[model samples]
Target chain A: MTRRWFLHPHAQVFLSVLLSAASQVLFKKSAPMSADASPFGFAAMSSGWAWLAALATIGSLLAWLYALRFVPLGVAYNLSGALHVIVPLSCWIFLGEKIVAQRWLGIALVLAGVLVTAQSAAKIEETIEKEIEEKP
Target chain B: MSPFAFALIFASIALQVGGQVFFKLAMNQTHAGRTARYVPALAAGVAAMTLSIMLWIGLMSKFPLSQLYPYEGIERVMIVASAALFLREKMTPRLLLGVALICGGLILVTAS
Candidate 1:
């Protein structure tokens, strides 16, 4: 099989990530106003919007299944939580949402942190490869 | 985050941002008595968003918060690119510099 044809587990994980990102943008753009728009409204207001949200949720579940097939649990969890920083900031700029300077700085720091973490991970992989090679 | 993990997180962030932009565009098409026409697009967008969230939950179930959080930076790059391409948003020198700094930082974090 050609290298491209081979589904590297990591590639699957990456695709899932991309899908997840795309889905988020779509859903937010389409989401209906909250049913509980009132000061004390308790129930969710129903519309076609909720149904769309449900569809997005299903897509996410499918992606999760693929992600779990190869990636370890610990790694997946960390990656998802980090979305908190990414999704909101992107919305600020692309969607014309207001973002304060402090928040922007925080986002920058988060990006820097990701790079550092990735580099460390690569070093770990290198060490592991060397150790495997050295083994009898 | 692992490289794969980082990529996934970044992608998810980008989509979330994109969704917001799409919704705004759709909403801008509003006119009296035309809410029904836009329903289909809205539905699709919502589905996509929910799917993204589900993916995130799945990732969370498996990984630690610290490891996954930094990959969010990838969204910024994606958003900036999208804005430039689709929205005709200006790419100011300061913004470009910011993007570079963020990229470098993300690389450092990932490499460390």
Candidate 2:
């Protein structure tokens, strides 16, 4: 095996999720808080946080692409749902945001979903690898 | 949220899903040695992703991160659906159950 442990599919997926969570936080930090937040506007790009958010997004995308080489897009996409939980928790911790009871329950449910999906992903990958091996 | 905002959210999600599917196609093309198709597929992927980010940032300016991020859960469901539709990825029962849980959580998050 190569020394690039981070290039491992699982590691790439984990890195992609972490970077995506960071990107969400930074994008929120960069937001102009204007009522006229048009979807095509460039207002967010004025902030330094926006640049960092862009960088985080690029990193996440590259990692996700790398992971997709080994894992099916379905599995990789499901694995990335971890970002929903991470972003909210990060916002609460670093951005001093509050999570209401209903939102907390929602986040918990999302976490459960991610865990279950990840488990299923492992099984799917195993079966695929086995089928490939058997295909003399 | 206004109807316009809801439309933006749905458009952003669609673009994101399109980006992922295109990127997956590019990767598969690369592995298949179809270099001619890879560049355009990868370019399409990048363009869709860039547009999605722009829309997401715009939406973030109007909504709280906590409230908005849950919408990403919806993308998880959509991507899996698209993967099944476009990529022919099998949708196991466990995967469906997981996605159903995510959708239920999203309804709660967005509803409250």
Predicted model with the maximum lDDT = 2
For model 1, how does the per-residue alpha-carbon lDDT over A1-136 read when each residue is reduced to its tens digit? Answer: 1343224323444455555555454444444234223211112224343346446545654555444333332233223433445565555655555656655665566555444433433434444334324431
lDDT of 2 by residue, B6-87 (tens): 8988899999999999999887776665679789989999999889878887887887765666677778878998999999
Off by over 4 Å in 2: A1-4, A124-136
lDDT of 1 by residue, B10-54 (tens): 556766656644543443334233767656655655665655555
- The alpha-carbon lDDT assigned to residue A41 of candidate 2 equals 52
* iRMSD, per candidate, in listed order: 17.0, 2.4
**Candidate 1 Cα misplacement greater than 4 A, ranges:** A1-6, A30-53, A123-136, B1-112
Tell me the deviation in Å of residue A16 in model 2.
Answer: 0.5
Error of 1 at B48 (Å): 20
For residues A9-111, could you state the per-residue lDDT of candidate 2 as single tens digits?
A: 7778999999988988888888857887776658778889989988998899888887776777887877777776887789889888887899888878878
In terms of DockQ, which candidate is strongest? 2
List the candidates' TM-scores in order. 0.39, 0.89
